[model samples]
Target: MSYAEHFSLKNIPYGIASTQDRPAAVATRLHDLIFFLSDLNLDSPATLNALASIDKDELVKLRRTLQTALGDEKNVSRFGIPVGEATMHLPIEVKGFTDFSCSTEHLLNAGEAVLGVRSFPPASLHLPIGYTGRSSSIVVSGTPITRPYGQYRDGEEIGFGPSRAVDYELEMGAIIGKPSTFGDRVSVNDADEHIFGVVIVNDWSARDIQGFEMQPLGPMNGKSFGTSISPWVVTLEALEPFATEPPAKKTPVKAYLQDNKIKSSYSITLNAEVLSEGSATEVCKAQLQWMYWTFRSLVAQQTINGCNVNTGDILGTGTVSGVGDDEHGCLLEMTKGGKVEWELSTGKKRRYLEDGDGVRLTAYAGDGVGFGECTGVISAAKPF
Candidate 1:
C-alpha cells in the first residue's frame, strides 16, 4: 500500500492535504512527505488555483525552488509532514469538465458491443468528439461512488431504479492552468501554455442507463453522478521525458488543430484493478500513446467555438483502451454489453460493479514517477 515511490524527488506533484492539527491547504509531495506551501509565500493568494494561473516561467521557478527545498534536511524538518498522517483532498476547484472520446480502439470496441460493429462514425476521424460533464460530481481518490438510479429499458418495458450496470472508464484528465477569454480560440501550438498537469480520471458510468438514454443526445444522469480523480496533479514539466509522438492522423485536421511541430502525447502506462474480498485483481492494462487525438488538440477543439476555459477546468481523455481483451478500459466493452461475465481473482463473477466493488486506476511513466491511485468504492443506491 506504500505509494511513496510515486512521489519521488523527480516528481513534485501538487495537491491539498489536511492533518489533525492543520486545515486543508495547498501542498506538494516528495517521497512520503507532504509539504504545505502556505508558508513558502509562492503568491499573495496561497491556493493551487492561484499558483496554477501564474506565468509558466514563474511556475517553473517555483518548481525548481521546491525541488531544492525538499533536498535540504533542515527544510524537510521544518515543513514536511508524513503523508500517512494527512488526508488528501481534491487538488483543484473544478468548475467545468469536458470528456473527449479520443481512443479509436475503445470507440471501435464499444461500437462492436453496442451496435454489433467494430467501426467508428466518420465524424470521429475529423473531430475530437466530446460532451460537457458535471463538474460538481468530481471527487478526489478514496471517495465512495454511490450507485445511481435512473431509467432504463427492461425487456420491452421501461424500468426505473438503481442501475445494474455501473462501470468505470479509465482516462487521464488534463488540468487547465490558464484562463481564456470569451470569443478567443486556443491554437494547438499554444495549448501547453494553458495546461498545468495531468491526473488519473475514473469516469464512473452506468452502462444500462447510458445505453438506453444515449440516442439523439449524449450521456446525462448515467455519467453525471460521479467522477473520481487522483489527488496529485503531476506537473506537465515532470512528464517532459515521457513525451512521444501520437499515431498519425488518417485524415488531415483543420488548420487550427495542427500540431505537427509538437510531440503532444506521453508514453504513460495505465492500469485498472478491481479490489474485492480483500484482493486486488488487475483487469486492464493500456497505453496512453494509443490515443488518436493529441491532448493539445482537445484544447484547440474546446476553444475553437469560443468557449472560455478557466483554471481548474478538466479535459478528460476518454477510455484509453488499447487492442485485445486484456486492454479494454471498462467492463461494458470487456463483457460485450453484459453477454459475458468478468471473473476476478477473488473468484467473483460480475458483468458490472456490485454495491461493494472497488475500482482503482494507476498511471505512470516509470518507477517512482506516477499519478498515485485514483480509487473509489461503490455504495448501495438510495431507494427511488
Candidate 2:
C-alpha cells in the first residue's frame, strides 16, 4: 500500500533513523519501509531543525513534495529502506525544555494534599505557571530511567538517599518549530503558527525529591533525571479535524492573550499504562482538552517575557488530570500523595513504581488513530 492509502495520509509524522554505519538520517515511514528525506533532497540536516528553520510555506512544499513521491511506485524503489534495518533516535535536537502546570484539579489537589495549602497564587490565574527543566536528560522512548537520589523529607528529619516515591507524569509535549530571537514575543493569536508538532511526554518524577525542593524553587533533581518522548512527531495541521473550542475562561486573559482565531484545542486522548509482573493496567486515560490552559495560552505566557526560543525546544503540558479518579494523570494525584495504594490487574499493589516496571504513554487525536507510545522501564540507581 502507498503512503496515502495505508499509512494514513493525513499524518506524515517525521523521525530520525539510522543504520549500523550511518548514525542518522531524517526520514518518514509507511509500514516497514522508511523513506529517507535526503533521497528527495527535502531534508539534509541531521535534525528536524532543518524543517523548523524553514517557513510555513516551505514546510508545506516539502511535505507536499514528499507526499507525491511516496504515492508514486517508482519513487519507492529508490528512497525506501526496510524499517527493520534502521534504529530510531531522538526526533529533535532539544535546546531547552519547560514544563507548565495547567491543570486546575492538579494544582488544587496537590497543594492541599502535599503542602496543605488552600488557595492558588493570584499570578497563576493571570498566567500559565511553569518552570524550566533539564533538557539534556530528555531521551527517546524505550530509554530506561534509573531512579534518582536526592534530599528528601523523612518524617521529622531531612535525609539524602535514593527516592522511594518514583513517579511518571503523563503529558503532551509541544515542539517549537519556529525560532524567535531573544526579546521577540509571540502573541496568543500567533502561537499556533510557531508550533511544529507534538509528542507524548513521560516526565519521570521522584515525588519525595520534588516535594522537598519545590518550595524554594521549582523542580530540580526531582525531575532532572530522565524524560522520555515518543519518537514520532505528529504535526499540528493533521489534528485540525479534532480541534475543540476550549471552555470560556473564568477570568479573561490580557489583551495580547486574546485571539478569537485561536478557537480549538486539539482533542487528543492520552493514556498512561504500567506493565509489571507480566500484567498491565492503565492508570490515566484523559484528554488534552481537559487542561485548564491550552497550548496557545501556555506558549503566549512563556514568551510574554522576552525569552528567545529555538526550534526543537520541548514544552510540556504538565499533568493532564481530569475530574475523576480514573482521569487522574499521575500516581501522585491518583494515590493522593501516596496516601492510598493501587492494585494492578495482576493483583500487584503499588504506591509508586518498582524496579523493572514499564511505564508507557499513548495518545490519539480522534477516534483511534495515534502517535504511538512513549515508554520507560524503571531501573535501580547506581550504588551510593
Which candidate number would show the highest TM-score if scored against the true structure? 1
Report how far residue 99 has shifted in candidate 1, in Å: 0.4
lDDT by residue (1-384, candidate 2, tens digit) is: 122222355566789989876668788776557777888666456678777667777777777787787778888877778867877789998998999987777787777668778477667767778999899999999899998989999999998988999999999988999888799888888887888888899899999999898887888999999999987787777676788876667797788767666455878888999999877899989988877778887678778887878899888889888889898889998888999999999997899999999998888885424677788999998886
Query: Cα deviation in Å at residue 321, candidate 2?
Result: 0.9
Please write out the lDDT profile of model 1 over residues 109-164, one tens digit for every residue.
99998889988877899999999999999999999999999999999999999999
Candidate 1 residues lying further than 4 Å off, grouped into runs, are 40-44
* Backbone clashes in model 2, listed as residue pairs: none
TM-score list, all predictions: 0.97, 0.93
Q: Residue 124's C-alpha lDDT in candidate 2?
A: 71
The lDDT per prediction is: 0.90, 0.82
Task: Determine which window of 10 residues in candidate 1 has minimal summed lDDT.
Answer: 38-47
Residue 95 Cα positional deviation in candidate 1, in Å, after optimal superposition: 1.3
Counted clashes in each candidate structure:
0, 0
**Candidate 1 clash pair list:** none
